[model samples]
Target: MEGNLAAVLADRADTYGWRDRPLFHSGAATYSHGEVHDAGARAAGVLRSVGVRPGHRVLIALPDSIAFVAALLGTLRLGAVAVLTGPELSGREHAYVLGDADPRAVVCGPGLVPRFTSVPVLTGDDLADEPASLPDPVPVPAGAAAYVQYTSGTTGDPKGAVHRHTDPAAYHEAMALGALGMVPGDVSFSLSKACYPYGLGATVFFPMFCGGASVLWPDAPTVRGAVEQARRHRPTLLFTVPTWYARLVSGPEPRAVREAFASLRAAASAGEPLLPSLGDRIEEVLGCPVLDGLGSTEVGHTFVSNTVTRRRRGALGVVLDPYEIAVRGEGGVGYEGRPGEDRAAAAAANAAGLGAGGQAAARIGERGALYVRGPSVMIEYLGKPGRTADALGPDGWLRTGDLVHVDEDGFVHHHGRILDQVTVSGERVLPLEVERILGQHPGVVEVAVIADADADGAGEEAGGGALAAFVVADEVAPPVPVLAEELIGLARERLPEHKVPRSVTFMAELPRTSTGKVRRSALGRAELSRNGDGSLR
Candidate 1:
């Protein structure tokens, strides 16, 4: 329990009191603690045979199956860094990650063999076929690198966030205590791929830490698939994102599914912000609190979480005690920004608002960025020394590019991406704020706000950009006139007039990443396409 993460996982398996119970469930393929531990040993043997030594990075690009879990555990068990790339990523992207990491070997599925023919490849299926035995757990420091998670960068490249072996265990111990309150005999299911740090924490580590059962699958494209698995397994808990929840609530009558989930004690959401309406709908349907937590790959897991006992519909809940949260500006650290700065800027500006546990939310005055100083923070960005130094300062504080503010009640509100802020008519406009307000409308299911040239405005519109919004509505096309009126009205009331969106376009669905974050640049191009204008296109 005190050594490396692989040791911790093995320790939990032996002493957590549920070692004999089912640890994973893939359709027609169930693996218990002993089976999984043996599979990890076999995977380690294969990796070692391929010249993967301690501290060497090994790329793992396989589907979510028992093999995926085994490979991850095996890599860690060998003290090899697991470069976890998603199976959904393009071959080029996979190559980028593999090349960056320069992995000693790759343990992937048969489908990925062609991409990296030069490197030694060991299929997860092949590893499963090998004899299972208890391999010696690799000796490593608690701070040794565990895995790499590549996040899409603003420059159209992917940046790898590296975590230490101790990170995931910290996540399972802290976040699970507050979010799941899980007990022995609990059954948990996660829709996120095991390769994802969040999924690894919520789906695998949490259950193991709590002495519960975890259900894994190869894939679940449709929410119905998730519901069917939940119904069949009668899992006591489910962890997923808001987009998946939205799809589920919007799908077929969920009465039976809801009733089947009667045994479920807690459900959690992450990856993206959960709309209050979506949370309400799920709560009404399943009669359970849909908890939400905000985390990033750099942080590894949920450090700031909204607990089930204190659920706030729209707010991103309070910060968990395991880490310290703060915001900072070039000038100083504080909470509540100076006057004339945007709402986010003013709220988070120049103030060092400390949480109950002495963790500070440092606010950069008037144009401040969010900063975090916590044990959960990543050690470094893999293979990118310059980027790592830029993000993690000499003081050990991590710069989070999200612009945010803390209210008097100590709730942090996300304003927008630091790069997404636009200046419209000489005033700062945050697309996320406008989009949040627009999303509150009953007719609107989702919305994305962007900046475009103001074709109609005369003087200020000359070569200048204005705000535009794209919406996906449920009932009828959101009355453009009413949408325009309400959006402008809401902006004027809650924000400056210049921050209001001038144009609105209704679409079937907004563009989103696989993880559910809206692609604002894509939405901007879509707006140009809708206008039938070649200029912006």
Candidate 2:
């Protein structure tokens, strides 16, 4: 089939008689499937009027709303490649994207119309009032470039991962249909936005594929606002990151919160590993299972997940059937640590019982870098060949850059990013491990551990290099010094001496990218850096 995403969705709505069903529920407004379909057709007319043609990139920087959905589908129907970015990003960030994508046109929110004078600009207002004029369906190969979803940019500059027309349905099949049998009765409420693949899979694709409604709020939601929306919409599927889930269960698990989540059958967390302690609290409050999944922007959506039927606590679940997951290393060992340091990581895996891809038991408990080969994997990064070559090989295997240990039961345990390993003393300490330990502290709302360097013997404690903790706590009884001490003590009790953070700094909030991933590189810089006396650097 010469497939188009807009046509496929419209077909589903028509075939299933879902035209009357709500597809999007925005603030005080509900848009039906048929209405959204007509809106997409009208949006296509708007884009075509502005001279956007097939294969041309149309950068979309709209908030989460039906307009965003319609514009995306309209771009697809016109055979244009959609480029997504967050509307809330800074002006500098938007300029960077404009330089990178060099899009033929821009579809932005009202607040951002002033920033795109270089390109033909369109907004939701343009699409809303346009007469319903359905254009002829563009006939393009299924493998044609459909959209570009940018990386989270937590480490550095973001790269646009180009996805094909066939990828979204593949995501729906692999996760929504395969992991959790989604139904028309389900309603999706996702905290992640449309600019992210996690949000797209949960809110736009998953629910739409199964004829369910997606709750779309234009703003980044607070805990109170999210709960109120859930109460109003009564969503059955909750999709968000681990940090948001942690916030949802903090303090008193209020009656309103529980009631809001009472209709939910399951909540899935990605972006980072869900701490088991936080998961327990989330499930307890919501009275539903919280499944942890892992995926990347390049792979479209989750290729590995824990479903309600088969969940392994604290581990990224078994690989989905649509993808092949392999852990690669030197001599069946993980390649992230210094020299033979990862030998201990292999040993710990062996102790817990390990095996890889039905290989020999002697190679058991191997720790290594993960590689995923999937149908939805991006063909390339938009325009950067060098960056694309570094991450993806000609053989179609994507170098995931994540380290993991696979158990006999096929559960994948995340060991943080390979680049995040901190050399504390002679031992290698993954900051995520220390961060996980520190997160258990009652006073610690959020914590990010990073390797910090100082002029004076690494601040006189960690010998050459030290691990620093950046924390966020809103309502703590103790002073900053006392709470820092308490968190350090807790880490010491839970982790090895070398693994524990050497110093602590309190922050109002950790610097995060658009996707909510902590900026470890920015953690100990500028005003975030600290002195021996606990003052900013």
Candidate 3:
């Protein structure tokens, strides 16, 4: 387990013997597990020849392809750390990562070599030219650094989460094998790219670990691209984000799209919360169960997920085995009682639908900051000890910064990020709650809720700040002004006054990170003109 990640596949090869089963496919190109293993060995030899020693960091900036997989596995086989990054990074962003990581060498396509000005570049062709043979895999401790995965820099500069050599095994066991139940011959495809942790697990490690094949889409996964790939590859498990599913269901010819998903045994959604309505629509249209889960770069992969057997619509599902989840109240005190133990009793008591107060009371001790501890957690944030200390506590629990409530049955429900919460008239408002309500409207395609500072710089009640919503509407929907008014009316009927969005702005789409998460901080700078009649210009 400590030597090399490629060794996992090698071991499988030794046990079952190598076959020509497709291990990686992008369009027409396909590589068997044996081919990938041999390529990884050759790539490792090339990296070694370039002076990349054990423990040295090698930046991998290639797009999702067999080369990317070879580079990653090759680096791991050499006992070197692979610094995975998106190929679309700007020069400035590349500079920041290069400066922070200080890698010994970089493995990327020739097109991206110019971005790594001073760093030693080992192009894909360079690895291809090397001999396809190498010495035995280098041995390293289980705790040795494996890779540095950067966070989606939505709020600020991305921080690299350093993981250990044993993490991939832990992630495979807990998520891929345990939660996803992937088996040999089950083809998988992910809308998320291989650079991100979620996608890395789904499209890279999970398949390799389970002896299954993975379909890689080199281009961005638009609705059409995703459907076409699904139909072409016939993947049994499809991993994508909520936005893609929303688009697929709302796209014209949903019936045709549903037929494309006929090969899918199950579909998984992550990176953002899946609105219950959207989940229902997906199941109704595609005839596939949508398993929603939550994970972060810091955790390597998902530690909490809804299994195919025991699915939950809004809940993030139960925590995976071998991981501990705790809810911390005000002052960071851990809750003593089990979550959701009294959920049934509370739900029975509030069966009359009294109001928000009744529901609030039912959720009273259940809400708090979420914290997790497990073997799969990252070692630290690279070059940021203070930030690392603030996130990973002394006792080893990582403060998730997410406000959540656990029901009596142990289902974890995410409220919103702690930093994203805003106060309106002295009452705290969670954006996810409002977004969930607005997402139910047929006209609303996608929505992001944020607090806008009032003109007077006082609270909303004092005319200082108010809750604003940026909404993306359906294609055939009415004019923005009419839809805005209808949404407001719907919110008024479903939500409390404090929770209702004071203003609604229509947008072509919400700005999102590469992984499909809304950039809340960017919403403040969005050029949304307000009409005199309170309609979006």
Candidate 4:
């Protein structure tokens, strides 16, 4: 409706009297749309009072609370780029990000105050205690950088993806309204903290744009906390990763507990492929179908997703119509990972001519790396043009690094990462494919299948053996022997012999990155500390 994102969103809400409606439901406190924008406007005034200016970056490292949202909205309102980071990020990480972004000011907790002695570090209280009145939103082009969200560092060191003032609105229209069919009556909750890119779209963009309310908590939720929030907030929709879903229904399926989420029509899962068995558990116990999708920081939000209305049982669902996809196979264009060569190959893939609407399909069921180009994708990676070139092409295509196969029904099936492929017993095995089958075992709460990183891809099998599975079993799980048999036996029933794990390790928990993806590379070191019986020493 208007130009700047904050201005436009504020205009829409005010025009509809939505400003008086509840926008954030946090514990017993509710912040109305007008209250949040008022706080945001005051926050902008405070940032401006402290000498912050348009086009400058404001690093915001806070929890999933009203203050974080206020800081983000205020920064955008002032025509500045906001750099988002997890509040729990280590001092070293914070230092690295501060150096990389070189922000004009910071909005963080008190603990970070010592390190930012030279720069202004505004706490939540500062934003809440600003002057009574403030100026209108600063004018900026829709394409101007509005924010920077760093990657989870799974692929490499974190790189900031710069999104535009128009992007969040685009995401809201394409994903929230178009894909999820969210309405003003909907209320949402997410396991991802707002600092995360996926969580940003879920809790911030979706709810705000749709005139729906988001349930906010200061910290990341535990399994109990997740259920509690669901029970209390009664959100109509939920967004999270597969890990939380498995944990929620683990140990036992609580039918009464499922009532906590009875209001939810569906829960969306991204960040990883959702295991079919876990998905079933979610459906049965949570009383909602777990919708699976795939996305990255560069893509801004889930570009390929499954909605409650249109979804398959075990697929990533169809690509959203606003975006176009191409699979890079043997003969297509792709990025070469070099400085200048980063223009094309890694994303567009090794395929022939482009199909209708920028698509280059893989064979009906063959594996190929995915490439996506859309209006919602990032304009560039902030301050990392070389790495950006490697990941994004001149054509606007982003190299997803995700290997997927399109089914005859047009659903996309995840086949692990293009770089994550490993050979076991002379056969190439997709860990995710096998992990999904093994994950179906009742005793398994979580699982990660990996081959030895040291193994030669050409001839020698990984670990000089077949595959291995690192499992976090339920508390009531059987001994390693029985659990191993059940998991391996389950995989054997659905997968080839080579794909079955030759060794099984019982772990209290899988090592994970802050954003919750399994740290697959860290598992490689577990082999070094193993005892004679093959368990971790």
Question: Best candidate per TM-score, number?
Answer: 3
For residue 525, model 2's alpha carbon misses the true position, in angstroms, by 0.7
Local accuracy of candidate 1 as per-residue lDDT tens digits, 1-537:
456676677677898655687888777667787777777888887777778789899898988877887888888988889998888888878878877889998888788899888799888887776643446888897588888987755435778889888777667755787656777677887777778776878677887677777888777456668777877787887788776776666545768668767777778888777777777778877778888777787888876667767666676666665666665554445553211236543444334454323445444323356677666689888778999998898876777787765555555566667888776776667777777777677666666777765444423335256787777665543456676566567666876667676766766566766566777777655345654321122
lDDT of candidate model 2 versus the reference: 0.81
lDDT, candidate 4, at 316: 86
Residues 1-537, candidate 2: write the lDDT tens digits. 238888988898999999999888888999999998888898988888888899899999998988898889989999999999999889999998988999999999888999999999988888766753668669888589999988988767999999998998877877898777789989989999977899988888877788888899888879989998998999998999878886777645556689888999999889887777677778888899999988899999998889878898889887776787667775443322211134556555555444353333334346678888878999899899999999998878899888787666667788888888767775677777887787777666677788776523453244556677887763633787788788889988998777777778887667777787887877757556576645355
Q: What is the lDDT ranking, best to worst?
A: 3, 2, 4, 1
* Residue 171 displacement in candidate 2 (angstroms): 1.2
Q: Which residue ranges in model 4 land beyond 4 Å of their true spot? A: 333-362, 425-427, 453-465, 531-537
1 or 4, greater by lDDT: 4
Candidate 4 similarity to native, TM-score? 0.91
Clashes by residue pair, model 3: 340-407, 340-408, 341-408, 454-464, 454-465, 458-464
| Model 3: how far residue 38 lies from native, Å | 0.6
The candidate with the higher TM-score, 1 or 3, is 3
Q: Local error of candidate 2 at 176, Å? A: 1.2
Mark the 10 consecutive residues where model 4 has the least summed lDDT.
334-343
lDDT of 4 at 379: 86
Error of 3 at 120 (Å): 1.1
